[model samples]
Target chain A: MSEAGEFDFIAQHLAPLSQGYEGAFGLTDDAAILADVPGLVITTDTMIQGVHFRKLEPWDLVARKALRVNLSDLAAMGADPHAVLLSITWPQAVRPAQMQRFVDGLKTDLEAFGIPLIGGDTTRGGELLVVTVTALGQCEHPLLRSGGEAGQDLYVSGTIGDAVLGLEVDTLAGLTGVHKAIVEDRHLLPTPRLKLGRELCGLASAALDVSDGLVADAGHLARASGVKAGIELDSIPLSSAAETWVRIQRDPIATLVKLITSGDDYELLFSAGPEKREEILAAAKRAGTHIARIGSLIEGKGVEVRTTSGELVRIDQAGFTHF
Target chain B: MSEAGEFDFIAQHLAPLSQGYEGAFGLTDDAAILADVPGLVITTDTMIQGVHFRKLEPWDLVARKALRVNLSDLAAMGADPHAVLLSITWPQAVRPAQMQRFVDGLKTDLEAFGIPLIGGDTTRGGELLVVTVTALGQCEHPLLRSGGEAGQDLYVSGTIGDAVLGLEVDTLAGLTGVHKAIVEDRHLLPTPRLKLGRELCGLASAALDVSDGLVADAGHLARASGVKAGIELDSIPLSSAAETWVRIQRDPIATLVKLITSGDDYELLFSAGPEKREEILAAAKRAGTHIARIGSLIEGKGVEVRTTSGELVRIDQAGFTHF
Candidate 1:
């Protein structure tokens, strides 16, 4: 079977990326199927030209980012992604060769993540390109934000402030070239903590991916669990570049606060009981990722930042959102 | 769990449409879980403003059409749709109330189809409103276009040409108001012949929805099946309004050809053995829809149309695509 008109180009380009998944049906059928029954986790994310990315960004990277964000959501739910359904609203201005580059990039990551493209739609419309990816996964112990209670230790996988800090090129202008590239790379290609999320399945009490700022997502976790998350400002994890950028700031604590509030961090923010600390560290080690206990969930509401000595750090809060 | 920022509006408005699906989890979790996957069939479609619809189209209808198109794909595969994951990139120009109407429209169909909203993502960007829907379904035996054999009888469920004809207001200007309204309604809201598709699961040798016009889609089915489809021009079913319009046309056959060449008919076109004719009619009766034996597959290639007397009718075949 072959894809019909308007959609033929997609199947011609992407059928190879289906990776022989029996359900993909060579992208010939209008729909794909998953034959077996298991716990299914589904998440979707959309990236549009000019909004989620600059027009000059490499098509491959844009495709990868579009995919990883959804995979990150699956990871946050402690699910291992198996397949994806993509919907691309292509603009007339985008050359077919550019779309081929986009598909090439998608193919690269689809193979890397071992998640095949099972189904999708390709259409011509809009002046701005829009890509929407829905990731499908299966997990035995799915994580949730409402699973935590008071007295749970809040933890984050990998470095927190880097991705957000990576966006502040002006603040990092004085830094070394290598340091600048490190932070910028973090912003461009975020490695989803899939293995770590799977490891935390039965361990973490609550979990979610921090696409919104750490503080904001922490507030979400707290609100969902009906508790307050108290984070020690000094304890937030940072990459070496972030550390260097913060050291030059007149008020280092204020800079750190700003880092935590400016989102685009695809890291996982989660909570677990104190009893699971050793196991979590072990899980992180096995996953080859770092985990830090940045804060603790307490009886209250919303998120609060405090110094190591318990001195409260009141954030300006204004312009904290991306809008 | 509760939804976080950037997606709060989607959850708050459409969460009610989740319809108590366990996987929806109140649209709170980062991803939704479908605990039991019974042969999961998935399909996705996207509609962008100024492309799929005009700026004046009602948001509610736009939302329904978006969902229905994906559902129609599932129907083409002889699957029972169970859930959908929506990704809407809301434009800044679209007011909150307008978005509310979109959700309301989505809610109406979600309930009508009994397909719950399991998961989705909402972000603001672009000057065009983009709505992408990924539908999930279950089917024990999915019908496929490759299933047809040379001798199979080609059948189509329900009328075909009304949708395309509905797009031409100037062509129908001389028609009565009631006749004009009928075709226009068919254009605005297409009924995905889901029940008919489900019934065709075992009976159909090949199947697909007619979104690409009857003749074009027949070409697709024939090419996929490695055979030829010979359609009887007079056998193509039509609504009363279409019949009346064709009667007044200076060239009725030419008008018919034009109608079949233009797309957007969400009807099921399939192939089955003559042995299943009685059974298929019974099935269509049970589905409460009309069925017509329009064509037959032969040991050849591509599609051909003929009159009742077997006279060849050549279609211009240009501008047949919506693009």
Candidate 2:
């Protein structure tokens, strides 16, 4: 109804982003106080409006997506979220309604994950909105992409490439009923797999979150771990919508490979010991998250996809390069 | 020379900036490993090109300026430098030469203060160039702005308003010789009184850095501490350059008032026990710093300046407001 003052804006909109996480003091004070934890893991990710997201997307979703992407980074390291600093590039011509709704979405995600927004900078900038979120996490020993051993089983949480399928279906005409709803939901609200990642802290040998297509991100893991990760082409966990959509158009294998390299899945790609496979499966079930046995880490570099006939297929590149 | 690879860019440019700091692991790893110390103080500030600095400014000066501003915050809280995270929004058109110079400048400041550039994010954005730095420090107990008590002495380290005057001269460009040099230096490099702030940790009742000119920032200290500060206008220290410049211009009081409200004076503004003034002054001298007693904390609601004629002048608003 009216313009909020600077202090009130911070108290209402920004502070709630870091509301309920353990060790994070309430944000009412000038600074957010955090308790000293054992193993602190900190990571920063910046999202630019046109570069990271289309302006056409709802402002509320933009706020959630910004927080989700940073959370995904913490999830990749198997770290528990403690607090985050949100540096926002406030765009000109942003209405009070938009600001309120945007902050509301930010609060929703923060309260859901129990992380508080600690400290941040606000500045006037161009039409392009920039949200830089630095997330602080704690772990006994962080799960790194460099720790994957040869012969370890590679598992991916939830389904892959649903966001891709959702994008395609949302653009095409005459897509109706449950298909439309599912596709839109997948695109708008990405699940960051925080619970699954926390469970995999000790269990996962090496891990990374799928941001840039499965194939590309998996390739990063393989390269970093100094091991080859071989995946069965048919074992990729594709959505029912993706299966139907691909059947109507191109060959499923080609489509699957393309999807793997497409990015924005936000699922966890992790390596665990072959001996621990049964334990991992049981844990995945208990977490209410899927774990698809996609591949196995082998002694070598480079990622190789195998045909059902055991034929090796080479991919040109693993993931998207920002440059 | 050929263009620098991403890894090389990090190793060459960033590694040197992290020198002389206590880091568990530096820029070599995917994530920085920071050892946690209890009572650690953290603060973040973001500066954008065009918003905070001009591109015409030397890369080294920009680097120095950015680090100084963030360091000012830590100094205000009476914290010692430990480590820093530098997030840069790089322009796509920037060549390696430009980046190299920028890195060189950043490295100078990092080395000077013994505050390492531990971790950061670099991303592409629009016309605006953003630099968000999070500086972390350790303190036994931080001197908060809300700690000042009635009957305490309010003091400011070094001189104030020179940086503001420097900004004015840089834009107008009608002055020359020492007049121009002092103003430019003030604008380009405003030192944070780190030693004084840390020394006053236990002795000082409350403290803060004066970025947003003296009168205004003192207002912040007063409001936070729940005590009103009374200032003698004659007690406000004016740089020789500021005084000479004022003599060349119109009414000295008006000019002084204008400079007092112009932001970007990175000096320490703090309150201490009246009895501890001598010890505070001696500690400042040992730290190779200077401080001037400007006012006293009194039982009231707001701040007022007493003139030479014993007239108390009420000044409500102080410094600059970005919004």
Candidate 3:
């Protein structure tokens, strides 16, 4: 823990994050007040040391990952970032410099995302560092997972499986050069796709960010919308690094299945009518984000994945289970 | 941890809390949307095991305390409770039944306050449980700590230092009967004073909940408002139980000073014009809460506690430090 008390800590270190935000009162008030807050979207995420990231990982990167995860949730709901509240549980043993680095990263992202830090509490407790971020967003009509129709086309933004690989980069033998950095960056920091989500607000029927593996998240959309999502295995987009990693494996199809089943992919997945494909393409172009037509939703109950040669892929599990 | 995963846990256990709140999407959506969110007040608090509570503390009371602390913050801002988001980090060793009790307590308070659970996240990891709650409130004009004037009369609601005594009740010999329970309950489950806060809306110039001890919190108000706060030691109100405990101490004045400097008193302290004394009494009466005239704000800086005969009292330390 730092030498400063909670009040001193806020005034000296965290108060700057609230600068330019009138409602934040430079975080001097007991609670922040937003004069106008219509159509607000709220999402929260918690990241812990040793659980979400390695103990030796840099604090700034950890802070970025924590903030981006919450932002990603806002994007999934088709909301633009508005403001944020952060609750940081500092382990007593960590250096104050590490925490300063984390705060610096928060400053960078708040500026980049154009969101202000409103109100939060800092406490010294527990053995592991924990950060819980609550991001409040604005949206006219949030695109929910339950809005999908059977005839709509399934589309996914950016490449998948890279973040999961990023977590295991050090363990994966012979994975070096740009491939290592590419995958590692995905784990350390993620793009929230707020602009892409904004573009899809009216164009797409259903949307969500894929964090708990593509297949498990598809199941979530399916269950919510009372439809089946069928993905063509060959059409699933992969980063060049993942492609290189996959080719060296003995069974490529099995390796691909493993990639899809692994979690931590922060990419937007949505469904739209076939007639709006061109419009979605234009939308993706405007957002400057890569998107691919992966599959389609059908009038059924769950999720299914099959190869071009008509082989069904069996997935034992699709994501992390807390228990 | 339970056999149920995150999705199943939400569906089976937590979805009921979100039933009437449409924005919560029955706790199924990635994020919740509040259609109208003007004049919003946002506050967050994080509580950790072994730090905030004992390892064997009952989960339901723990949950109640967590919820009330956030509510207390809202009350301090003179905002009505609107909604809540809870992020729980579960330990792997805890039984599911304990978590259920916590949920039950949350349900009780949510119904009692007419505040719905709008959104939250649940994750499992680490050796200790952590609960973080973000409360959203509404108010036209939030009562900030900086709104006080030098001539305003200072008042405190309920009694001071009961909670701190409650924490040390076991250690203080011969302290028994109703006094022990009163102090323990004050420590375990504090009243948020929402009604009193609402009553003080336009009446009080500055208001804040006393969480970080009376003297320290008064110092905060003084520093924020650029004024001075002086409290008479003889005029400070205390519960009958505390009066009895004080008489047994070696120096009652020293005990009172100790009480004022110790934290965890969740009482509302505010400043108002002396002309509004009668009106403030009526407001407190209607809210069914006790109020005491303690002192007044003066033109200057910092806080002072004086004996009725006009002698300055010295304080070594006013509150806890994170380090």
TM-score for each predicted model, relative to the true structure: 0.95, 0.91, 0.97
- How far off is residue B236 in model 3, in Å? 2.1
List model 1 lDDT by residue over B7-107, tens digit each: 47755687877889997888878999985857788988888888888777899999999989888899999999989988887776668688879988998
Expressed as tens digits, the lDDT of each residue in B1-323 for candidate 3 is 43236677778777887757879999888899874856889999888888887787788988989999999999999899998999998886768798889988888888889888888888777788789999989888788898888888999999998988988878878677788999989999999999999888998999999887899888888888889999988778899888888989999888999889887788899999989999999999999999999999999988899998999998777654444
lDDT of 2 at B305: 81
lDDT of 2 by residue, A1-323 (tens): 21126556765666555556332333432233456766776767677776667766777888898888777877877778877877776666566687788788888888888877777666554466677777777777777787899999999988887777666664645445677678667766788877788888788899888877787777768877889988888788877776666666546667677777776788999999999988898878877898899999998887888988998766665654443
In candidate 3, clashing pairs total 1
Q: For model 3, how does the per-residue alpha-carbon lDDT over A155-215 read when each residue is reduced to its tens digit?
A: 9999988988888898767666799899989878989999999989988999999887898
lDDT for model 2 comes to 0.74
Best prediction by DockQ = 3
Q: Rank the candidates by TM-score, best first.
A: 3, 1, 2
Ranking by DockQ: 3, 1, 2
TM-score of chain B of each: 0.95, 0.93, 0.96
| Candidate No. with top TM-score | 3
Each model's C-alpha lDDT? 0.85, 0.74, 0.86
Comparing 1 and 3 by TM-score, which wins?
Answer: 3
Q: Which stretches of candidate 2 lie over 4 Å from their true place?
A: A1-4, A12-32, A164-170, A173-184, A251-254, A310-314, B1-8, B15-31, B171-174, B312-317
